[model samples]
Every structure is written in C-alpha cells, then in structure tokens.
Target: MPRKGMRSLCFSSPKTLAYAISRFPSPSRSTAASLTPRPSFNESMIQQTIAAAENMIVKWNPDTSSFAKVTSLFYEDRNEAMEFIKCVNGLQKAMHLMVTENSGSDNLVRSQNLMQIAMKRLQKEFYQILSTNRAHLDPESVSARSSRASTRSSTSDYEDDGTDDDIHAAGDCISEVEHVSVTAMENLRLIAEAMISSGYGKECIKIYTIIRKSIIDEGIYKLGVEKMSLHQINKMDWEVQEIKIKNWLDAVKIAVKTLFNGERILCDHVFAASESMRESCFAEISKDGANLLFGFPELIAKSKKSPEKMFRSLDMYTAISENWPEIEFIFSFESTSAVRSQALASLIKLTESVRTMLTDFETLVQKDSSKSPVAGGGIHHLTYYVMNYLTCLADYSNILADIITDSTPPSKLHLPESYFETTDSDDTPAPALTIHLAWLLLVLLCKLDGKAKHYKDVSLSYLFLANNLQHVISKVRTSNLQYILGDEWITKNEATVRQFAANYERLGWSHVYSSLPENPTAVIPPGKAKDLFKKFNSIFEETYRKQSGWVVPDSKLRDEIKISIERKLVPIYREFYDTHRVTLGAERNLGLVVRYAPEDVGNYLSDLFYGTGSSESTSLSSSTSSSNRRQSRSR
Candidate 1:
C-alpha cells in the first residue's frame, strides 16, 4: 500500500501505471523531451521540509510567539532556540532548492517570506542573548575561555586514548565560567553563520560592532584615557602633563593587554564563520579607542622640548614599545591600519623629542657661564646638576639604546677616541646612549675647566678641578652608570684626579719646600741656621694662611689631599726642624725664629683643607705663646 499522504497518486489500473511510466522518456530522447523537467520524489520531500520549517518558524516568530515576548529564547530555553536555528537553516536550503527548480514557483515566494520572518526572529534572539549575557561574554572572560579551549584541544589530541574517561577528564577541565562563555560564543557563532549565509551579514555586523564598541570605549574611559589635541597638551604645565602621562601609561597597558586584546578574541569567536567579518567587526569596535589611546604620546612629543620632560617622554615610549607585539597583531587588519600608524607615529615622535631634549641638555651644560668660581674649591653647581641628570638617564639605557641607536655626539664637539673605551671583555662598541652620556660629561668637564680659571690662585684652580671631577666619578661608580661607563673610564679618570691633586700640591706649597736646606744633616754656621729658620717661618705662615680657606667637599678626597700634603711636606719639614733646632737654641727670641716644633707640623697640616681661615690666626698665636713660655722656663 502507498503511504497515507501519497495514496492519491496511486492508480487502480495496470494500464494507467504503464502509460504514466511511458510518458517519462528515456535518457536517449530528443533535446526537447530531455529538457522537459519531470517531478521527482525530492519535490514532495522539499515541500514536506518547508512545511515542517514553517511550523517551527511561525511558532517562535518574535512578533507572534508569547514565549519569546516574556523570556529570552536563547537564555531561558536554549533547546527551543536551537530548534529555531535548525528550522531557519532548513528553510534556507528549501528556498534554495525551490529557486533552482522553478524560478517563479509559488513555493519559492512563500519560502522567501518565511525566511524573512525567521531571520527577524533570529535577529531578536541574537540581540537578546548578547545583551543578557554581557557579563559572560565580556572580552576578558571570553579571551580567557578561548585560550583555555585552545590549550585543552591541543592537550586532548595528545592525551586522549579515545576512552570515555579521557573525554570526561577533558570535559571536566572547563570551569563554570568557561562553560557559560563557550555556550554564549557557540550560540552567537551559529546565529551569525545562519544570518551571514542568508545574506544578512550587515545586520549582524551592525549589532556586534555597536555593543562591543561601546564596551571598549567605556573600558578606555574607565582606564582614564582622554583625547586631547596637541595645543591642549602643549599648554599644560609639566606638573599637569606629568599626571596625564602617568594616567596614559596605566591606561595603555589595560587598553592593549585586556581591553583591545579581549575584544579581538571575542570578535573572532563570534564571527568565526567569516574571516572578513571578524576583522571588520574587530576594527570597527577597537580602532577609535586605540587611536585615541596611542595618539596621546605624539601630542606630548610635539610639546615644548625641555630637559625635565625627557623621562616622561621615554616613559610613554616604553609603554608603547612593550605592547607593540600585541598592537601589531590586534590591529593587523587593513581597516585598523590607522591605529598601528598612530602608535608608530607616537613612538617616532617620542624618539625625536628624546633626542632633542638630550641635545638641549648638553647645550645647557656647555653654555653654563657662571664666571665666579665655587667657593673653597668645592663641587660646582653644574657638576651636581649634570651628574644627577645623567644618573637618572642611565636607568632607561635599554629603551634609550633603541631610541638613539644611530645617534652621535654633535659634530662640533670633538671627543678623544679613548673617551669611548670600555673594558677589554666588552668588545661591543659602547651603545649610542653610552657615547652620548660620556660626551655630556666631557662637555661638563670642559665647562668646569673654563670655570676653574676664574680663581686668582693657580693652585686653587687645580684643587677645584680635582673636587668636581671626583664628584663626577663618584656618581658614575655608585649608580647604573657603572655598567654603562665601564671600569676603564673610572680608572683613567681617577688617575686624572690624582694628577690634579699632585699639581695642586706642587704649585701651592713650592715656596715652603724651597725654604728648607738641601741636606738637613749638614753642620752649618749659627748665622746661616738663623737665616734658614727665619726664611722657613716666613714662608710657612704665608702659605698656611693662604691655603686654610680652601675646601674639599668630599670626605675621602679631603682626607686624601691632607695625607698627601703631609707625606711630602711633613717629613722634610720635621727633619729640617730637628736637625737645626739646637743651632738656633742660644739665639735671642728663639721662639720667634724656630716657632714650629716637629709635632706641630702635622697639627697645622691637618687643618689645611677645612676651609676655616679665621681659626688659623688664633691657632698660630696660641702656639707662639706656649713656645715662648717653654723657652723662658728653660732660660
């Protein structure tokens, strides 16, 4: 017996069946007969499929379905939503078959209308699912879930033995958050694929971009990013700009690492069916926020170039540099190229600004025209400022290495080859930053050399050089500059400091050294001895009074200068005094002639570098009174 619905097609007579079969021509028939389309059993199947799809589609249509009006179809009843998606897919296929079979068929027009209604319903569901499950579909959670999914997929490929236990184990690895996110992403992808395949991609993209873009924009705002013009940034005081730069640094990390990155992941997952759709969706969602976030540095770079602003510029440079890989990957789409260009422009601008600030700082050091000398031969103000500045610069050497990689010192400033030398173990040429910093020091030293000449005394001039250079070297040795400017530089500069000290000792104390006899052991006449003692006393008092005001600010350098002077002068003076003391013993007013005892030589030398000139006269008067008392007691 025929099936219940097909009973009407059954023939009662055998002749009717034979005649119907005869009308269906063979494959060898004429072209006209061959082209004459014959209805097949598939026609009934397609009609049945369409009928089934209409029942499901009309039942859940957003306009007519009571269940869809009160509850989210996807969230509240996922099975029903799945059935609706399947029904829409079946309707689409049925419509395709109807069009192919007969272009003007009534069934084709009905399928088209049904398709529109079904799509409208699916669109509503898609929007509802996205809006209701926003927390579950957030970029961070979605990104994390995507990463775990990838990891689990790869792990299961290796670890699974096609056993139920292994499958369950893999399934158990997913957390509740992952399950929720996965369900949301899968549902979104299915609806997206159905809509896109049905030629409604623009609608899906519109909905996705609007919601995701707002989320990204809000995220950026909450992270404290703001769009400001170059004029606004330039007009801001450094203190205000500094706060903004800090906020930008923090915002950029969250924007790139979480906000933008998460958006990219979520977009890709939702539109996994079409590459073009995902790329376009991601670009539309994240481009505006990214461009504004990155454009800030370029504006700051265009601001007034000042030495103090260099570090903040470098900080902005570093934030972008560290996140460049993600920026490149996330904004790789052609539509989002503006974001990448903005980031690159900002980096280039920051680099140029940093280079300019360094040049300006070096120029400032060179043009320092403070004519008056630092009192008492102490460390100069310029030395303090430059060393402190360079010390801070050394902390960003890695970033600076990339910024000024090809930079060189100014052409007019000539530095010796030895200035660039590093330790033997380090064969790599000193980085550009190292050379740049070394040149700045050289400029400072040259400036200090010019300042040293302002002192009237030649010896004080040399003392000033020693004091300032020692300070520069001390700063280098203690900070990150030690690694940057190697030990060889420190050693060479230390020798120069010693040379300055020697020159100071020679020039400052030459008169006192010349007052002593060549050989202290020689037996000379009393008149000659009295002449020698008078000459020595006169020279010693004048030199001591002159040098007592000189200062060595560094404690180590101070003690060193004092010990050096004592080592050279004390032994010779003490030997001359002891050998010739008795020769002038009977001379009247002996205390006046031989005023200094051997022990008193060291005491006076100890007081030379303290920069206390007022105490020198009092000390000399007290010593003379005590010596006179001792001499009177002896008489």
Candidate 2:
C-alpha cells in the first residue's frame, strides 16, 4: 500500500483498516506474550491507564498544562524521567508489533488504532520534555544521569524494556535542539539575501542597521550618547574606528555577494570616512565655504586679511587633495589603477566646482559692466582673483593630465606635435583635456573681453580688450597651462591683438581720407584749398576730441597704435598738401593755410590716447590747434 493510503486506513472503517493491516506481514502473538504478559484489566481500566499515562507525559504544545510542568518534575525525579522515556519507547514498539500480529482481525485492528494514537502523542510529549531539559543539561550531565537511570532500572525489580539503539536515538534528539540565537541569525541572513537579490537597496539598509546593532552589542563600537565617553581620541581613535569599519565591511561584502550574486562591493567605508574627515576640515576653514564656492566678491573683499578669506577656503580644497593619498591608501588592497582613477576623477570634480564659482563671479562682473564703467579696481581685482585661482590649478597638473588622457578618444589621441609645446624632440603626444581647459580659460577671458565693448569710447573699448587679452596670455604663459596651449596658440592670439590695433587705426584714420575727396585731376578749384583745409581741420578735431579721454595703460601698445595710424595717414595727407599748394599761391600763405606738415600730423596723432596731456590741453578743437601751428613752424 502507498504511505498515504495506509495513513488513511487509520481513520477509515474497521474493515478497511483490517484489510490494509493484513497486506503487511504478521508476527506471532505467542512470542510477544512470552516477552510480556497481557493485562488482566477490563477495557475501561485499560482506557483509564492510557489517560493517566497521557497526563503524566508533558505535551510540548503551548495550549496544554504539561508545557509548564516539566522543569520541576525533571529536577525532582531524574530517574523517573528516564523511565517515562523507556515507557514511550515501548509504546512505539508495541504499535509496530500490533500491526504485524493482528493483521486479519477487526477487533485487533480497532485496538491497534487506539494504540497508534497513544504512541504518536507519547513520542511528541517525550521529545518536548527532552528539548526543554537539554538547555540545562551538559553532555557529561546527560550521560551520567542516563547511566545511573539504566543501572537503577536493571538492578531494581523493573525490567529493561528498550534496546541500546532506542536509548541512543532519544539522546540524539535531545542533543540536536538548536540555540535560539543561532536560529535567529540564520533567518536574518536568508532574508537579507532575498532582499538584496531583488535590488532592494533601501531595504538592505535594515541589514546595515542590524549589523551596526550587532557591532554595538559586541562592543566593537561604543555608544557615544553619554557626555563623558571613553572611546579613543585623535589618531588612535581613527585607527580604532577604521578597524571596526573594516570588520563591518567584510561582513557587508559577504552580504552583498549573497544578495547580488557575486557583484563586487566597493569599499565605500573608505570613501565615506574620508568624506567625513574632509567635511570637518572644510567646516573649520569656512562655515560659509559653500557661498565662497560660488564666488562672493563682497565676502572676499570685506575680509580684512591681506589676500582674502576666499583664497584660504580655496587652499583648503587643495590641501585636502594634496593629502588625499592618505585617504586613498585606505583602499590599498584594491588595484592601483582603479584607486588612482577614482582619486583623479574626484579631483577633477572638485576643480570644476571651484571653477564654477569663478564662472558665477564672471557672470556677476559681466552684469555689473552694463551698469558701470570698466575702470573700477573692484572689477580688476576680481578678475585677478580668477586668474590667481587658475594659476593654482597648475599644482595638480599630473592628476589633470591623467584625467585628460583617460577621457580622450583613441583615434585622435596623438595630436600634431605643433599643437602642444614640449621640451623634448618633436614626437606628437596624446592630446589631453588640458587643451579643453585652455579653451575654457579663453572663453572666460572672452566674456570679459566682450563686456569691455560696453564702454562708450571706441578707443577705451580696444584698450580694455587689449589689457584683458594680454593678461590672459601672460597668466597662461607663467602657468603649466602654457604647455597645454602651446606656443602656436599664443602666436595666433598675439596676431589677433595686432589685428585689433589695425582695426582701431582704420576706425580713427578712415575719416582723414574721407575729408580729402579723390583729387585725381591734380588741380584745385578757386578758394577750394581753404575750404578743403577747413574740412580737414573739422574731422581731425572731432576724432581727437572723442579719443582724448581714452586710456591705454601699456605705453608700448599706445606708441605702436599711434605709429600704425600715422603710417596710413601721413603719406596721404602729404600728397594732398603738395597737390593743393601748386594750384594755390606758392609762398604767399602756403605754410599758413596748409597748417600741418607730415611731422606735425604725426606728433598730433601721438597725443590721441590718454596721458598725452591734461584733459583741456588734449582737446584738438581748442588747445591742440595752436600747439599744432607752433609745431608746424618748427617742422
């Protein structure tokens, strides 16, 4: 019969039970009777005895009174407990014998049904008592108690009812009861693994919480709730914390592997610890470092210290970066390439954030340019602050270079040798992101350059653009950025400055040519020379009046610009003068009406920019007319 069919026979009709029992082998009733005598009691008496035995056996079920009564009974009659164990074992054997001996009898099968129920209940109760008692009994104590019980059962009038195998089986059940703590941990591990496998990272935070609790309970980390704590301080404290964190990290690694099916877990503990230390350092430097990061010109200027407090905050970031190797070494077990790459990436992010502050400042200054003139010292110093910060970045050139190399695409890695300035032979090196940095720097300079055009005077606008452009090139040359931008880049920008000078010359001198109309006939109308000279004087006075207040700080740039203007205008003016003088009187009033020789026109053009004379003296309509005539006589 199938096991399920046989189990059903226990609850089926008596005929069915007997039929199922008869299919199995039968044992001799006489041999079982010879081993133990049959009871002389009536059926009621037998049922009563079974009930009393049930009452004596402690049920493991929480609903029963027997659950609460084992401790005292086991403490008082240890030998009696062993006798009860033997009694349950005999009941189990008797049920097996009944199934074999009385297979064809309906009455025997009914009796056997009752016996099986009693045996199962007795087995459950017996194991429950054993489990409850095992916590208090060591292996030696159990062994000693069982031996005494065995000797007492054999020597006294009681019979030895169980075989050695039955006793050993009972002992095994008792010994195998698991500890509550171990069971709880195992359950936690299984649940955590399930949670992690499902990509429930937030839920896994509970696992971390549990691990932290365990760490605290294990005394690995002290609870610092008290005011007077006993934890290690300073460097020693850090060492202790690192050790604890490493231990927790190992546990987390196993948990991550279990949950994520063997994905590598980054040691974020190292990064997290480093971030904590860095934040503390940053907080100490400036409570408002975040504001400084976005470039507060007022805070920087208002601070009484020599350079600025913002500069100190800037240094703080660099200091952390310089000392970053110490924190990076926390992951020394990881691959060097990975660690350094991560470090470089973090540094790049920091540099970009700092640069963002400068960008914000530039935006502020640009907005200010629309409302104010370009000559304020505040704007100038703010521009200097930006340049100074860019110079500071050269300190991290190697890290920046690596970042550039890693981000560059493979096809164009080796740029032309001429694109970068290097000390060695002309082998083209891999192009770097430093070139991008140079471009960004140029963009910032151009922002200020464009803002310079807001000035009312055209010459002032050129002067502003020239000064800022020169400042940009000089700052780049002095810094490591020069290697990235190359001599070719500088040469190109220098040519651009010369172009601006040429443009300015064209704008100023274009009027002079327009004043003298094309006289290709080589003749002048009567009284036309006087009208032409007056027209020329009107255009010259107007040009110099507008340009007189415009300042060019660099004397060399000023002189070069004036010479360029003169080269274009002096020859044209002289040719017009010689042609006009022949048609008019030769010596009668030729020098007086012509007004300016070539040398006098050159000297007047030189005075066009600021610092040539005082404001009243520099005006061509008033003071310059008389000075030009005296100078004309000398020429």
Best model per TM-score: 1
Report lDDT (Cα) of residue 167, candidate 2. Answer: 44
TM-score between candidate 2 and the true structure: 0.39
Highest lDDT: which candidate? Answer: 1
- lDDT of every model, 2 decimals: 0.77, 0.45
The residue-by-residue lDDT of candidate 2 on 388-462, one tens digit each, is 766765665665554445553223222343434445664775366555456455545555665766777575566
> What lDDT tens digits, residue by residue, belong to model 1 across residues 377-432?
88899999999999999999899889888666554445456555546777676667
TM-score list, all predictions: 0.82, 0.39
* Error at 409, model 1, angstroms: 4.8
lDDT of 2: 0.45
Candidate 2 residue 77 Cα shift, in angstroms, is: 74
